[model samples]
Structure formats: C-alpha cells, structure tokens
Target chain A: MQERLGKWLLSWPPLAYLVVFFLLPSLIMMFAAFRYPGDYGGLMPLTSEDPATGKLVLDITLDNWRDYLTLESFVRLVDEPLYIELFIKSLWYATLTTLICIAMGYPLAWLIARSPKKYRDLMLLLVILPFWSNFLIRIYAWMILLGPQSALSKAINLVVTAFGHEPVSLLFTPFAVIVCLVYVHLPFMVLPLYANLEKHDMALLDAAQDLGASAWQRFWKITWPLSLPGVYAGAALVFIPALGMFAVPDIIGGTEGIMIGNLIKQQFLETRDWPFGAVLSIMLTGGVLLMAGLAAAVGRGKQKAKQKHG
Target chain B: MAKRQSWWLWAAAALAYVFLYLPLVIVVVYSFNDSKLNAEWVGFTLDWYHKLFNNREMLVAARNSMVIGVVSALAATFFGALAGIAMHRYKLRLLPFLVLTPIAIPEILMGVSLLIFFVLLNVTLGMTSIILAHVAFCIGFVAIVVRARMQGMDNSLVEAARDLGATPWQAFRLVTLPQIMPGILAGGLMAFTLSIDDFVITFFTAGVGSSTLPLQIYSMIKIAVTPEVNAISTLLMVLTLCLIVLVSKVSPGALRAE
Candidate 1:
C-alpha cells in the first residue's frame, strides 16, 4: 500500500543511519579487539591462520583477556601504587569538582529561575557564555592565568606582599585540576539544575510560606526537595566525564599528577600497545557504566520511597 | 521582609560568575598582550591577531574543522529530523532506548571502537572519515533537540494540513518544518560547534595528516603553549559565542526547554 510505503520511507533514513554507521561500526570494532591483524592488516577468523606465517595467529584464543587478567598485569595496573594513588586522586578531584559545581550552580540557577523575566536572559547568558568557547582553549587560558608569572599570580603576590604573606602556588596541582574541571563542566551542571528549578510551581512555595514557615524553612522543605532531581542530574553530569577527563589534567596537572584518561591515551598512542589499550578502554567504560547504573538505581529507589511516604 | 531576604544568593552568584569568567577574561586580554610570555601584560598589540591571520597551517586546520562541522551538522540534522519524527509520530517499540544508547556509551569507547573498525576495513581516515565520525555522535544531539521541539508541537496543525489534502511531504514541509525549524537550526549549530571542538575522537579517527583545528591545537599544546594559540582561541571563543547566540535567538525557549 502507498501508506505502508510512505511509513517505511519515513522511518528508514534514521534507522539505516543508526544501524549502518553507529551500531555496525561499534560492533565491528568490538569484534576486532578480539583478534589480531593479518598480513593485509585485516582481521582473520579463528582457525584460518597458517602456523608458518605467524601473522597474529588468529585461533580465537583468550590471550587478550588472559593478558589483561594476568597477575603481573593486574598488579601493574590495579595493585601498582602509582595507578591506585592516581585513581584515588582522580576520584577526589572529580568529587570536589562536582561539589563545587553544585554549590556554585544551584544558587545561580535558583536566582535565574526566580528573577524577573527581564533579567533572566542576562543571567542565563552569563552562566552559559563561557561554554560557547572550545573546552581546550578555556583550559589553556587557565594555564596562562594561573602560571607563576601570570596576571592572577602576580596580583595575588602583590596582595601577599601587602599582607606580608607568602604567595601560594595555585597552578600545576590537584587544585588547578579541580578548578579547570569545575569551570569547564559548570554550565552543563547549571543548565539541568535551571531546568528542574524553573519547573517548580511557585504556588507551592507560596503555600509553604502561607503556613507560617520561615523563608529558610520553605526553602529547605519545598525548594530543596523539588530541585534534588536537578542536583543529582547536575552532579552526575559533572562527575561522570570528569573522571574520564584527559586534557585538563594534561594541560594543567603538570608532571606529578595525571588522570586515568591520560594513561589510556598514552597506552593507545604513545605506548603503541593496542591490546592493553583496548583492555583499559573496556575497564574505563565499565567504571563509568557502573557509576551511572548505581546513580540510576539510587534515584529510582529514592523516588519510590518518596512516593510511598507521600 | 527585608530581614528575611539575604544577599547571600546574590553574593554567591557574583563569585560563581567571577570564577567562571576570570580565565576567559584573561584569555581575551592576553590575546592582545605585546609580549609572548602570557604572564605579564607588557602592552596591548594586534601582532598575534596578525600572526593568526597569516598562518597557513592554522588556516588549513580551521578549514578542515569547518568542512567537517558543516557536513556533520547537515547530515545530523537530516537524519535526526527523521528520527525525531519517528519517535514522535510513530510509536515504534524499543526505538527510544536504541536512539539513547549512543549517548550513554562513553565517547572514548565510541572513538576506540570506530578506530578499530576503520582499521579492520582498511579504510584510510581522512576528512570523510572525520565527517562520518562526527555525524555518528551528532545525530544523537540532533535527535534530542528535535525531539524537544516535536514534544512542544501541537499535533492538530499536522492533522489539519493532512485534512486539507496536502501530501505528506507537503504537510511536513509546510507545517512541521516551519514549526520545528528553530529546533533544527539550534541542533545544527550545536552539531557544528561540537564537531569543530572535538579533539579526542577526531584524534583517534582522523588520518595522520588530517589536522582539525582542535587536533592542531592539541599537538601545538603538547609541544608548548603559546600566546599565538591564545589569540586563535580567543577568536574561536568569539565565533562560538556568535553561533550560540544566533542559534538561541532563532529558537525561543530552546534553552532548558528539554
């Protein structure tokens, strides 16, 4: 029928795009991770390799997985003091950045959502304008600003001299890493919080106030509870990617500190260890998905509890 | 009433703004700094801007990024428009989750997998490959934005257009297109920005010689930071700002509308 044909045409384009480009490529790549290259740099099937050729003998062996799970490799990657220390450092940095973003963004979102219609656009623009630029450029700018001789450092030194205090080294540390991550991801945090906050029915707060509740009381009871979804959303948005971040640490974290993302990058590009790189990618992906899954479960549980209590 | 309302919120907001804009402000200022140190402000000069304009390599990278951006934006918009329509008009089971999986996948995994896939196929990575990669990720963004517009659309307009004996294409072109054009434009601009700004994925999928602006910047930074780079970044920031504004202005209620 013409109708059926029309419907098929309507859906085919997008479906084909997703299937061909996104899904197929990803599946192929995942499969490639399981095999080694042949003479033509093509993936060979299991049992197809000639014993004499020794060209990445593709026996569908568990060698790749075994290599990753070996005690030495495990010790090197996980038990190694440096990787564990850096992982902890990265976790805390991401945590601090997430907290800072929430602390900064929530009140701003509240202000924008509550402000008069005339000034709302101005406030939102201020919040989002920084994100308009490239993320790398922003971090690079931070490097310029926070470097020892930079204007910010110079200004702080001047003040420190005035007060007879020592000028602090703020750049090239965990402090700088957190600052950069918060700066870059702040808008992502703000936008979602703004969305959730703006959706709050003003009349509910009015009712809370009408019940002789103090302004702070109304905020704690009504506003805070209402915006918790946004807060969680904002925190997750900042925290998830911040953990896997590469450039910020590379540009600003200096030699002493590095993120796992940087390690993954090094493995792939600098080290030229494709198999190890694939394993690391899988691990990092697993970590992100695990965290996201936990967050979702917690969110659902909280919602269910709230429903029951209400 | 005066006692009940504290200026704490306002103060917090001001500090947050300061934290956010200080680096950007420094970047803009240092782009015109007379000296190369990027530390001290020697004097204002247009020398770096001039250098940026004269650099052929930088210009080539910028061109590559622009080409990728435009192609990806248009492709994403087209496919995303259809996906959005399918999600909205047709109640296809399991389609929503399928569309969303692309976003959930860590961008690094997506990048690595695609790299491996291209290598397996003996496909040389180039501008075309970059465009393909850009579109793959950008489609999800386009879908989300277009879906937002679709949700807000009143269905009656489409029905009325159909009732008036307009063909399906005519109905889409005349009624649906005009209504969602803002969303499409917004999505397209976002796609362009994201594509141009991307480095990591591009680094993985892009061929050895195919240097996007971000890739070039990445390599340059790896060598060493430069004030000339600052000047380039400042220009990029300004351009991105203009594009965001243009897109936002077109799409009223586009911000936080989703």
Candidate 2:
C-alpha cells in the first residue's frame, strides 16, 4: 500500500500539471467553439439552451457551422479574386523558399557532415547559431536593409549607377517578403537535412566511384536519391510555417505582397467578424492538413518502393 | 575517393550565408548612424540608444516583456521537464499521441482557440494570460529537447541510486538530473527565446493593458518607419544573435556550426 502510494505521488507532478493547464484549457476552448453567445457577447452554458426557439434568440443553433459550411461562404471565398491569388502566391512562395533552402542547405550539410571529425561539431554549431535571435528581429532587420534609405539599397544603387542604370525599387514588395521568409526559416530546413544527411555512409559513394561511375552519375544515382528523404522533410518543415506566416508579410509585404495569414489576422482583429474569421481559420487549417496528408502519403509510397528494391 | 563538382555547392552556400547575415549586418551598422533615414551613410551616433533608455513607455514595455519571458521560461521548463520524465519512465496511455497534436496544429488555430477559451471562462487577458499562452507553446519545445537527452541516458544509474536506499525523488535529483542538465538548460534557454519572440498568439490573447515588446514593435512599424525603430530593431537583432551564439557554445548539439 505504501509502495502504491509512492508511485502515485511520483506520477502526480506531470499528470496534475498537464491536466490542470493543457488538457483542461484545451477542452474548454474546444467546447467554447460550439456554444452560442448570450447578452454581452458571452458564451451561454451548453446545457442551458432553449429547444424550440425559432427566432434564433438565446438558443443553440448550428449557425456558426452553417455560416462556415454554406455554399454562399464558399462561393464568396472562391469568387474573391484576391483570396485565390494570395493562396496561389502563398503556395509558390513556400515552394520556392523550400527549394532554395534545399539547394543551399544540402551541400553545406554535406560539407559539415563529411568534414574532419574535429571541426565538424564546430561547423554545425555555426550553422545553427543564427536561430537563437528573435525571429521577428531578423525580419525587422530585413526591413531596415531593404528600405529605400537603408545600407543595402544604397549600395545596390551605387553599383547600378556605376553600371549606368537608375536606382530600382526592391523593398516593400513580394520579392522582399519572400527573401525575408526564406532567410528567417533557412535554419529549420538546414538542421533536419543535416541530421539525415549525416547518417549516409561514405563507403557507398566510394563503392560507386570504384565501379567506374561518373561523378555526376554517382551523385544523381547514389547521393541525391539517398538524401531525398531529408529534402522532403526539409520541404515540409519550411513549407508548413511559410504557408501560415504573417509577421514577415505584414512587415515586408507593404503594398504588393500579402498572404492568407494576413487576411486571417485582419478578419479576427481589424474586422471583428468572429464567425467569418472562424470559418476562414477552419478552412486554412483544413487546407494545410490536406496538403500535409498528401505529402506524407507520397513520402510513404516512395519509402515503400525503396524498401521493396532493397 | 570520388570527387564531385564542389564549385557550385560552395558558391550557393556562400551566397546563402551572405543572404542570411546581410540584413543583420545592416541593422548593426544602422544602429549607430547619425541620419534618421536608415538609408544614407550618416556618421556614427549613440543618440537613438540614449533615447531608447530614457523613454518611459519603451522602458516599461521592455521590463514587462522581460518579466513575462523569465516567468514563462521557468514555468515551461518545469512542466516540460515533468512531462519528459513521465514520458520516459512510464508508458502512459494516449499521452504521447495527444502531446504531438499541438505541434501539428496551425499556430493560428491555437491562438484563436485559446482566445475563445479564455472568453468562455471569463478570464481576463493580461500578463498572466500571456504567460500561460507562452508556456503552452514553449512546453513542446522543451519536452522535445529533454526527451532527446533522456534517450541517450542510461537507466542503470537510476537503478543503482534506488538500490542504495534512495527514494525515487532522491534518485532523480542525484542521478538523473546531473546527466541531463545540459539538455534541460538548453531547453530552458529555447523556452525563453521562443516566449520572448512570440507575437501572433500573444497578439490575439494579450490584454488591453499588457503590451509586450514584439506587440509594441508591431504597432510602431504598422504606423510608420522611424530611425528609432531601426535602432531598437538593431539592438534586438544583436541581442538575439548573441544569445544564440551563447546557447550554442554551451550545448554540444544545440546549434549547427558551419
């Protein structure tokens, strides 16, 4: 009995912590999403709703869900030219950023991974060192660089002037936002790629070369294929956060660039349209989940084929 | 050894590093600029930093953000360490799967859901609410770091401690804690950094009166661009970069060195 009591006490810390803070609060929030608001825009208790209220006053109606799921809302979202454009723009930005990260990260990861054992640890630390800074600060710094009177802009203008061209406007646009996002999230892409790439054996590359395979052929056949898993993981890592990014776009996007996350923020904060905002949030989340599911499925299929071949 | 084409790879990496650090370099330089435009090459001046220190609201906001960051980091590390221990020692039903869901969920959803939750519970949004939100997100990061450390740790040490007539608590305190202290410290730093950097969720849930530094910066930037902002931003960037370097120097696998 004393032993059982000791075990229970030992378990109490984590269990009590999560249950009180995480589980309870999350459950309450999930439930809050269901109920209707009463006077003063407060949520009425779920069990105390009227049954036969046709006037839709102080009653439980599936109104929020209906408002979200209706064809009109769908059509309204779909018909809006900006929504689809922003959605597509978001996809392209995320995809392009992921690719760039891979292109840049793979070789660096390779170099660091295959470096002399003594310096390899130091190299890896340097690569990840930039991430410790606040993410917002980094993005904010980009604004200073790309702004009209900033150092980067001034330097570029001088170079262009030497080449006999007018100073070009580069800041406060989609290009600026993409550049900032890619720079900010590059560490996320690199770390995972590095982790996986470090696992590949050096003997395989040597074996391929010993078999008289060309350098390009050996890379395409051996190195690239093996590192594809990391590439996929890296892509997912960059793409997921990039898709839902807001602060970067809001800061750097200025006029020409805006993403779906910005729209969601506007709905919630500026517009005060809670129902519509909730619907948008649900849709955006659903879209991301679907994309992630599809990516996972593709990854699984490729892994299965690799397993079969091996 | 098979030598591959390394030129392109080297160029790409060099370019990438330059791209990553250029903005940071610019921020550091512009912080001392005499000109307010942040574009022109003005002579060095510490006036902005002087103004930043003297400003009452700015000082208050910085203090508030620091307080929140310290509290949230400690809370997150405490809870996260407990969770990691639970996960390591026991095979609790549904705990692993449930914990992983927060990582997969969109940040905005978490933000909105928490907003609704607090509204329903009639809890006022303020410093405590912001701290609570920060801890929720930060715990996942701390748990992941601590769990990784736990994985490499030997269970025999705990067994040996217990066999010597130590309580479970004593065994953990003397045996396990020392082994994973680096990871725990690294995780705590991560929590501190993440909590300080957060904006989206905090923006949604922060009370009317409680203004964090990020929230403060966001509002300032939205209205107009100022050299004061450039100065503030530059300071922030340097501080963050320094923190990252410090953290990396302490932990073996904390930062990927290049």
Candidate 3:
C-alpha cells in the first residue's frame, strides 16, 4: 500500500501538468477551428450573460449559431487555391530537403559508424555541434554568406555574367530556402541513420564480398535493405519539421518561396484572424497525423512480412 | 575485422563536414571584421564585442534568458525526475504519451496553441506563460534522459536496501537518489540549453518588453543584423557548447541514449 502510494506520488505531477498544458491546448486549438473569427484578433464569443438570470447562457442557437460560429476557415482553405499551392510548395521543399539529407548524411553517418572507436564519439559531436547552436544564428550565417557582396555570391554571379546571363542573387531565392532547410535538418538525419547503421554485422558484408559480390551489390543487398528502418526514422524527423518551417523562408526566401507555416503565422499574429489560423493549424495537424499513421502502418506491414518469412 | 572504406565516401564525408562547419566558422570569424558590410574581411577588431557589451537591451535580454533558463530547469528537473521514476517503475500508458508527444510534435503547434490557451484563460502573455510553455515541452527531454539512465541501473541494490530494514523512503533516499543524481544534473543542463535556445515557441508567446536573446536576434533581422548580432550569437553558441560538454561529462552516453 505504501509503495503504491509512492508510485502515485511519482506519476501524478507530470501527468496532471501535461494534461493541462500539452493535451488541453491541442484540444482547444481543434475546437477553435470551428468558431468564428472576431472583428479584432480573437474568436467570436460562443456564450454571453443573461440579463435577467445574471448567469452565462449559450449564445449559440440553432437558428443563430451561424452568427457565432461557422466552417469558413476550412471553406476558405478549399475555396482558394493559393493556400493549397503554398501547402504543395511546402511539401515539395520538405521532400527535397529529406532526399538531400539522405544523400549527404548517408556517407557521413556511414563514415562515423565505421570509424575507429576512439574517434567515433568526437566525429558525432562535430556533426551535431552546429545544430546545437542557436537556430537564428545558423540562418543568419547563411544570410551573410549568401548576401550579394559575399564571396560565394560574387563568384556565382561572376560565372553567370561571364556566360552572357544576368547576375543572380542567392540570398532570397528558393535555392537559399532549400539550402537552409537542409542545413538545419541534416543532424536529425545523420543521428538516426548512424544509430541504425552502427549495429550492422560486418561479417555479413565480408561474406557477400567473398561470394564475388561487387561493393555496389553488397551495399544494395545488405546495407540498404537493413537501413530502411533508419531511413524511415530519419526521413520522418527531417520532413515534419521542414514541412512547417517558416523562419528559413521568412528571412531568406524573399518573394519567391513561402510555405504553410508562413501562412499560419500570418493568421495568428499579423492578420489577427484566430479562427482561420486555427483552421490552417488544424489542417496541418491533420496532415501530419495522417502521414505519421500511414508510415506506422507501412512499417508494421513490413515487420509482419519479415516475421512470416522467418 | 578489416574495415574497407572507399575514397568517394571519404570525400563525401569531408565535404559534409565542411558544409556543417563553414557557416559557423564564418560567423565567428566575421564578428571581428572591421567592416559593417559582412561581405569581406578588411581588418580584425574587437569593436563588435565592445559594442555588444555596451548594448543595454541586449544585456537585459540575456539576463531574462538566464533567469528563465535557471527557473525552468529546476522546475522541469523536479517534475521530470518524478515522471521518469514512474515510467521506469510502472506499466504506464498515459504518462509516456503525455511525456513524449510534446517532444514529437512540431514546435509551432505548441507555440500557437499556448497563445490561444493563455489568452482564453485570461493569463498575461509574459515570462510566466513562456516558462509554463517551455516546461511542458522540456519535461519530455528530461524524462527521456532520466529514464534512459534508470534503464541501465541494476535492481538488486534497491531491493537489498529495502530488505535491510530501511523504509521505502530511506531506501530511495540512500540508494536510488545517489545513483540518479548525475542523470538529474544532466537533464537540468539540457533543459537550460533548450529553454535558452528556444525561439519559435518564444516568438508566439512573448509580449511587450519580454524579449529574450533569440527574440532580440530575430527583431534585429527585421531591421538589420550587424556584427553585434553576430557577437551575441557567437557568445551564446560557446555558452551552450560548454553546457553540452558538462552534460556529456555528467553522463557520457546521455546524448545518444534517447
């Protein structure tokens, strides 16, 4: 009985705190999506005081509920193609970033995993150190590097001009956005891929090699197939955060590149349309949840197939 | 086992490291540049560092971040250690969900929803709310670290303490607490760095005059980012790097445990 009481004492504080803070707020955001935008910056009131009773009453009526709340936010999202296009563009950027992270991080993760044990820790630290630095600072570094007068920009523009083309600015283009996104998310990819790659049995590779398999075949047959779980984990880590990213585009994307995150920010702060913001947030949340569910199902199916084969 | 690595892998990995380090190297280097252009190096100077120290608003933001970092770390470590203990001991479904969801979700979701929730509750959007918001997310990280530490510990010691006529509290006080102290300390440092480095959540939740260092850096981006911004960023990076090293020292495998 005493130990059971101790267990309850240990659990309830975090459980209650999270229920109030994390879970409740998410539920509220979902609820806010169905409400109407206020004339100012809040949601329209769904309740009011009754003069006679001096008590609160539900202002939303069956006849006049439309006055208080509506589905306008979702309607607006569908009615206009602009938001859809922005979401699509964000998806493309995230997809490209994930693919790039895989291409770049694969070699680095492999190298670190295959390194001498004494140096492995140092190498992994070097990879994640820049990531631990301030996020704004990292983007700000790019802002300077990609600025028109910076050496990189000047060199690229010089080449373009020599080729009889107009000078191109790198700072505010889609290229800059993708570059920053990949830079920000590269560590997420490397860490998981390394964790997965580190556990591979080298004897399997040696056997494949002794059987006259080329390095490419050895990698494709052994390493690649085994690394699928890592790839999935890394891809999820990079893709979700990249999908909703606003800061990269806000600072360096210029006029050309904007995503769903920029729109969500606008609705809450700039536009002061809470319901629309809630709606956009709900769509984003739903999309993320759906993709996550799909991935889990696919992963489970693969697990089942492997178990059956065994 | 003879490890065979190809030449292309070495070149690719070297280039990857360059990509990771170059921007930071430039940021640190250009802070000392004499020119305001941030374009090319004319000559090195300490003027940016001097100017950064003299900037009052920047100092106030730094102080605020320090206070927030310390307070939230304490609060998060206390609660997170409890949660971690519960997770290790009990067959908990809800506890893990609550603890881990905040870490997995996109940060902006937390930022916006907290904004709405605070406004709805009529709470002022300021340091307290920001701390509340931070602790919500931070609990997950601290819990994960502590739980990972707990996983490696042997059960016999605790059981032996209990069987030796010590009460449950005495057993916990003497045996378990000493073992987990390093984990608690490491979790505290992680929470401190995360609260200090946080920007997205802070952006939505901050009101007038409650600017943090990251918010101050961001506000500068709208106007202009001079070398002064670079100076503070360089300092913040060094500070966080130190804290991370301390964490690694306290618990060598803490970073990879999660």
Top-DockQ candidate index = 3
**Residue-level lDDT tens digits of model 3 in B71-175:** 989999999999998999899999999999888767888899999999988889889988998899889889999998888888899999988888999988899
Q: For candidate 2, what is the DockQ?
A: 0.46
lDDT (tens digit, per residue) of candidate 1 on B1-258: 012335898898888899888888888888899997877778989999999889898999999999899999999889877777778777776556556676665566677777767775668999888888888888777778888999999999999999999988898899998999889898888889889898768988899768999988877876777788888888889889888878888886554543
Higher-TM-score candidate of 1 and 3: 3
| Model 1 / residue B119 / CA error / Å | 1.7
DockQ of each: 0.58, 0.46, 0.80
lDDT of 2: 0.73
Could you give the CAPRI-style class of model 3? high
- Residue B54's lDDT within candidate 2 is 85
* Runs in model 1 lying further than 4 Å from the true structure: A1-7, A28-85, A155-168, A202-215, B1-5, B93-95, B255-258
Estimate the TM-score of every prediction. Answer: 0.88, 0.86, 0.97
Tens digits of per-residue lDDT for model 1, A1-310: 7667666776788788778767787666545444443434333334444778866654445665542233333335566577667666777888888998988898889888888778877888888788768878888877877788766788888998899987877778877888889889999889889888878888887788788999889989888987888888787778878888888888788776588778867765666555455656666766677778876887788799899999
Candidate 2 error regions (>4 Å): A1-58, A61-85, A150-168, B1-5, B245-250, B255-258
Which tens-of-lDDT digit does each residue in A1-310 have in candidate 3? 9978998999999999999998999999998988987767788877778999999898887898777767888899999998889888888998999999999999999999999988999999998888889999999999988988789999999899999999998988999999999999999999999999999999999899899999999999999988888888888888888987888898889879877888899999999898889988887777677667766777788789889999
